[model samples]
Target: MSVTTTLRPPATNATAFVPSLGIALASAAAFGSSGPFAKSLLEAGWSPGAAVTARIGIAALVLLPVALVMLRGRWHLLRRNAGLLIAYGVVAVAAVQLAFFSAVQTLSVGVALLLEYLGVVLVVLWLWLRHGQRPRRWTVAGIALAVAGLVLVLDVLGGMRVDGVGVLWALGAAVGLAAYFVLSARDDTGLPPLVMATGGLVVGALALGVAGLVGVVPMTVTAADVDLAGLTLPWWVPVATLSLVAAAFAYASGVSATRPLGSKVAGFVGLTEVLFSLLFAWLLLGELPLPVQLLGGVLVVAGVVAVRYDELTAPREPDPAPSLTPEAPAPPR
Candidate 1:
């Protein structure tokens, strides 16, 4: 039930507003395509662990310099929030990626993604049950429609073969991703989004690196193992793109966007990522989503929209003021 929203700083300006919104949209697009990008690398022979390691590791390296520059004199913040930071890194960033990669190893990318969106439902459920907020009839109906769409998309009853283990991994990914949003919501303004992203990535990198060294997962650098067979480009192309553009830029921009959009609107607007991924796949990979999967994607969007609508239209309980001081106000969607 954990959901992290990006930490926001109080600010008001047309310039900041436009840029933050743009960045948020772009970040969502990058994140949405993460699955397809990772899938491509796997098809090109990269192990799921290796691909994820490369992604977070290189991204950490890229952001480290930026974080250090902006976060000067803030080592105390990092030290103080070390525990939460580690949770953000390991569970939210690393575990989600690893589980997603494993899921796609056995499930079609679309089906896996659809399953992962179940996290939105989990978020709604958490808000209802734990927060004691009653969900409206429309919200409940939206959830049912989304679930039905998933069944159609997955064709679960149509004898589509899927690995049980992979399904479990995807379900876990949903949980991790849901936790990520919740955790982000708690991020304080004193800790900038880039700084938080950097810390999390560093932790994720170190943990994955350790796992690799221990033979729990392979981290070999053999040229043969890094082969890129399906692609006409160099072996490092995907890795580089994934690390800098997809992971580093994507996460940084996403956190920045939260500053203006607030957590809830940002989450729902972020759903546009699925559409972006589908479009990207059509152009780059020549992959077309099935009819049901496309419909499912629409339903998923609808469900998130429902949540946003409920929050906006319904009377809301007063939120407890966040305990963490110096909270940044998230931006409007």
Candidate 2:
């Protein structure tokens, strides 16, 4: 999405602002936990595809009732927005998670997250090239800084050997994430965010199931116990956590927060997921980030902040003129 397209117009009412920010942060925290939890399952011999399928599938089941209630006889909305729902499910939900999980099999959680987040930059480029929306100066600077930070985080100059397959998977995840932002920013459908999120999860889960059944992606799971924070627990423990908190709660809260925060600010706020993921990985998986990588993370946050600042300070578009229908003649008088 272009900077303009991504940045929502300022909220006229300030009353709901704090609550929205809280919800967004909560969503980030939940999403941030996914990496560590999923990685734990992977370590216990679950394939990425299987883990993600289970995550989305169970989460969809959990949210189905709430979604139905929210529809409240407005069920036609689902039918009307089927195409968008399918696109959101397959690309944004299924593809993104699958790619990221696959990448994490070979990459560190923090690194994988940072790579996936490059999708934000992809959004800017896609908007510029496809829509001819030139980015503002701040966006340009943010992109430049983020790119530099990515290089540092990857340690390309350090010649740290990385898996080519993992890199490809991470990039794929990035593209999927960019598609997510673009799709979420669209307002034509008028579908409620909660409904959209719930439907997307259900469709995405079904798609993953079909993919697994077709043998397109490996689907493997283990009954073995999983390790978490120095304790060994049944395999289902992490799976339940992943399904409920990371997938269901995270997606729901995220969609709700986006409505109030706007796509750009919400997206920038989502940068916290990287940090939260890193923290979780360290605490749960004993994978601490290096000093250089931490510095690079700082730069990434700064870049996003600058871009959002520009969006906030940008001039507002004037309201359109009222319709000019001619007045009816006073025939009765």
Candidate 3:
């Protein structure tokens, strides 16, 4: 099997540009809803592990047909990319959600999302260290600003305190999120985004199921009503929304967007999910952002912009063809 496959480069033409941006934004919006929806489930007595498992499991079933069609008898691709798919499932789908949902149990949705998005900075660091691609001055400045924003988000000096366990879980989510981007960027796999999304979700769901069976993480659910936007609703309402819109559409659109936007741009674009998460959290959970935290969010977005600008303007070198030796893999958003 080839270690590297030729991945699609970022789109530059107007025709491809507008649609990709639109899809990416839509993906962000869809994904943003997950935080509030999952929080509602948590309030209703659903364990983080159970909620995440159901979300991925349902999404996998929803996308299975499309993935199979895309395969078109190309079964060997799955075997060839088994490692990549497994990593995507374990880290991106299962672990990321487990950590994020655990954090949201104590942290507000927006703050939890902000923490997970620290993955963007981690991605930059990974590229710098692993690929030996030193960041330019703007990138360095961006990292500094992002770190400052993180401190304010945490409110380290303020009397207000976030749960220590929540902080740790959110940081774990950040690492998983970074893995998602790094894995998704590997274009040499010859695997379509839909296939990867489907496979990862299935694998992740199974892994979570096993964990639940063994009681590593509590798995619980309730049939009680859920509160959303000041309205009482059936439990199924949020679960359906989370599974279909948030997980299925979000992952599909996100993977497609990455193909045209490139992982770096796509990752930064995903920061919009934090803003949307804040809105949903306020509306659905009544958790509004603090003024200082909002300011910190602005700084975080600014930092991402600085880093993206540096990437866009930096001189480029032609990429060499990917080698066919087995090596590490990457993930999706």
Candidate 4:
């Protein structure tokens, strides 16, 4: 806990920037792999609820032993951070995945994802209004470019007419996405990234399971083999990838990256996941992206680099020196 607390202050150690960036990009790649794998299962008769629940649920089971090992004799830390873990599960995990699935029921996946990724913008706005961390000129430019690129990347311009209910669901998911970065960046909870990731997976799995049982989310699954690319593999292959790589590794690495990068830069870098998602989809599902989408991916990368550059180059504000004596009280009116 102390290590997380002491090491997480933004820009505290300039030497760590590049490695953290690498880890962040790796996390994005892992997250991006989810779509292609999930698509395979869905095509094989697995419902969205079943896919999402199994992704997080089996991931929770896999990580439980590791979390317990890390938390040896630190039960007090878990007790103290219970609310944070619950919020992480509900907002960052369950709401985000569930709402996205709901939106995709009526909107094209690209359109639904575009709407949900509006959370990147919400992160900037939330920081400006809530934390008074106004963006400088460079950050503003980065945000603008990132958004324009996202439009092209998703090719929402060529999208079909969307349902209002689906739009609402995507918007709700946007809020959850914002919570994901904000909560992931928090260091006050005194819990390690692994613990946070494991707890979130557990809580999210439980919440989604309840929804499935209550008829809120449809739960259908099959034992049919999944056809990924040209190969016929067991259904468990994609399921394993979703749970282990996407849910477990992605979240653990993402949480670790946010500590050094802070929420703003980390959120921008996270845009790379869209590009990776397109890449994986093309490779595994034969969904090739248009040239314009490729161009958009370039812009997204440029924007993220700009934001990271701004963060690294920004002047550090040193802690004020401790006063030798108390200042005199101000004169009363």
Give each model a TM-score: 0.79, 0.85, 0.83, 0.92
For candidate 3, what is the TM-score?
0.83
The residue-by-residue lDDT of candidate 3 on 1-333, one tens digit each, is 223323455665668867987898899899988877887888899887888888889999999999999999899999989988888889888999888878877886546766788888787777667676677998888777776765565454564347889989999999989877777766677789888889888989999999899998798999999887788889888899999999999988888787777666677777777667766777777887778868767876787678667766787787998999988667655
Sorted on lDDT, highest at the top, how do the candidates line up? Answer: 4, 3, 2, 1
Candidate 2 lDDT over 158-228, as tens digits, reads 65346889999999999888777676665556677778789889999999999999998799999999989
Q: After superposition, how far is residue 33 of candidate 3 from its true place, in Å?
A: 0.8
Better of 3 and 4 by TM-score: 4
Residue pairs with backbone overlap in model 2 = none
Which 10 residues in a row give candidate 1 its minimum summed lDDT? 221-230
- After superposing candidate 4 on the true structure, give the runs of residues whose Cα lies further than 4 Å from its correct spot: 1-8, 12-14, 318-333
Model 2 TM-score relative to the real fold: 0.85
Candidate 4: residue pairs that collide? none
Per-residue CA lDDT of model 4 for 35-114, tens digit only, reads 98999999999999999999999999998999999999999998888888888898899999999999999998888888
lDDT for model 4, on a 0 to 1 scale?
0.88
| RMSD, every candidate, angstroms | 7.8, 3.8, 8.1, 5.3
Model 3's number of clashes is 6
| Full candidate order by TM-score, most accurate first | 4, 2, 3, 1
Cα deviation in Å at residue 144, candidate 2? 2.9
How far out, in Å, is residue 68 in model 1?
A: 1.0
Those runs of model 2 whose alpha carbons end farther than 4 Å from true positions after fitting are 1-18, 103-114, 129-133, 150-159, 162-168, 319-333
